[model samples]
Target: MEKITHISVELRDWIVNTMKTGASPEAIANAMIKKGFDPIFAYRTLLKLVNNTPVEVLAREQQPYIYEIPEIGQKGNIIATSDRDIKVLMRVEKPFILYLENLLSEEECDELIALSKNRLKPSRVVDTATGEIKTVPGRTSSGTYYRLSETPLVATIEKRIEELTNFPIENGEGLQVLHYKVGEEYKPHFDYYPASKINENTGGQRIATVLIYLNDVPQGGETIFPKAGVSITPKKGAAAFFHYGNSKGQVDRMSLHSSIPVLKGEKWVATKWLRQSEILERS
Candidate 1:
């Protein structure tokens, strides 16, 4: 939102020419800095131009056909293929189903909704490109979230983990729900360690993630991993499970994902993150 300084018609033409020659924004910014321009000014100017340009113009300026995750599964019930079986869906391989169809009853859904009415709050929204911070605006799209550590839902979700993975479940800092209304979507990103500034190694390296869809959207609202070629739609009461850490504590890189924009209706999901250690170091 802050305006960039040092951006002029000449600088704009230089940037456009450089881009025509296949220079990335980073490369262009560095080149300008070396030529006595402020690096931040160059970077910010580029961002402003990109943001202000029409989508069609920007598309012409960048790569054509950016890869996207395709919609694969639907709401209700379906089995998921493991990484070994599918090879494309990366991380831990196993067949699993969306839990929304059978995990919780309508009454239970109502209960969870009632509980969320007061507890759900805005989630931290980060602009990965600019390092800007803002609270997500509303319950629509990638906005509001309820931290699971403070909710009864955590216990229920852990029991399901035990039944499915046969691994003892331990409580941690808890999960967060990302609710999306029509037209809302989360961009591609990785779910790993939050920066030190946020939690100071508190999450102890996320090991796995379980996302349970609480409400069904008539269409769209899929969890997508473009690199993995996987997309799963939102279903009432169903969950998606994926592992991110190895037995030796190395983080798996394949867990990067995104949420496809909701085209119609609404979506609500409950997320559970498994940690390598207890949330609290001291009892």
Candidate 2:
């Protein structure tokens, strides 16, 4: 017997269940190693299960970033930008999550909320199977999108984002303004286009998401990653950034996230999704 490297379906389910209950990846790996599995195999297996990608696909999609992000500063909290210094509040590795502070000023946040108030409409999501926008059951909110550099404020924000991520402006989508009231929520979902539903007109695959919090919710409204066992509370002028796309074009399942329901005050967010190629601004 050449040491069974294959993870059985039962074992895979157990691994996913354990992760959902808040077990760290390292702990999970240790347990599997004790059960007679290779360390490399154990690590990869956990990643594949958590990401919901096939084992073979996961192995092949372990590719490098197409563009590099500049180094984090000495304390690992400072990110150098052309005009502003973004402070990192926290970081997570498996799904590549970052909690950033002071990415926007209070004045900027208020102005954005004011600008989007009159333009808001019911939020819609892409229908994975059809590639069309539809109002789904899980998401209950309203939103609007600003064309790239549409206003002086929008342009300035976009420029700072470009400097921070090192992703080209041409590859970025419009800034989406979203509003959520008490009892509203967006269910867990991936930011990247599904492997089976890739649409060229939609600008290839979405490589990353940068979300700026416009206002703080008094009680609820947290950006949560169920599989990663992470929840980040909303704070005005703060932001969250995560990347899911790899050179092999496989999406990271650990990037699946959602907005918990607003319990007290409303929540507002401005989101920018970066794609692999240039997407012309229509409006």
Candidate 3:
């Protein structure tokens, strides 16, 4: 008997029906082979059809990211909240980053580190395809998240950020503390996500970040913006704040940044990710 290589319409429909009736691929291939179909072709076709991978659509062309000055940019060198005073150490315009000092205090920094020291776990990223949190090689650090305003210290910091940026505290995600030992680094990446990942319930698309340095690094662990030729050193109680997204849904690709490998000492930092609107609890 001659072996069939190409699948006909009738045969394809039969195969689909057989699979839907709870037949396994191995059993289907055996049946196809008994009917004089090419063994290799039978197995391969069944496998492909079983997986049925979806095709990805091409993204439409987008306009350049429009630059919108953030509230922190308009303020004077000193930003005074009801409880604290933060100083603007430096400002970078191309990507819109602010070097802030005294966002936390010496005592606050130490306390945060101590609180998170034992609770640290390997850092993770949101899986683009599956929408799951997962660990990846690019980010090599241990970190933990604190519930929004969970502690007096956390509440104080959140209040300060709310007053400083004029964005409501409800717009911010839980505070995160990260620890990078020597040689650990977070590879360069954007903070903004693809539109599909933004969930309105957990606030909308992230618009900005307030990454506060909880402790000074003796050497490396600098926040690097490669495109802008900028490197911000980690200082105790200081921070690097960058805004990328705007109301029009435009995002600044120039806000790309990373944590360079800690060449000398351990690095500790607290991070707050801000969204476009108040975060609603998942129902």
Clashing pairs in 3: none
Write the residue-wise lDDT of candidate 2 on 1-283 in tens digits. Answer: 3444776433454355445433466776776676677878888877877788775433433444353232322336788777778899998876887889999999999999999999999998765433446676678899999888899999999998888887788889999999999999987776776554555665788878999999989999999999899999999999999887776665667777889999998999999998877775343
lDDT of each: 0.52, 0.78, 0.82
- How badly does each model clash, as a count of residue pairs? 10, 0, 0
Q: Residue 37 of candidate 3: its Cα lDDT? A: 78
Best by the lDDT measure? 3
* TM-score of each model, in listed order: 0.57, 0.74, 0.78
| lDDT (Cα) of model 1 | 0.52
Best by TM-score: 3
| Model 2 weakest 10-residue run by lDDT | 65-74
Cα RMSDs, all models = 11.1, 10.0, 11.9
Model 1 regions more than 4 Å off = 1-101, 126-133, 136-154, 166-171, 194-203, 281-283
Error of 1 at 280 (Å): 0.9
Q: Which residue pairs does candidate 2 place in steric collision?
A: none
* Cα TM-score of candidate 2: 0.74
Cand. 1 TM to true fold = 0.57
Q: Which RMSD does model 3 reach against the true structure?
A: 11.9
| Local error of candidate 3 at residue 30 (angstroms) | 28
The candidate, 1 or 3, that scores higher on TM-score is 3
Please tell me which model should have the higher TM-score, number 2 or number 3: 3
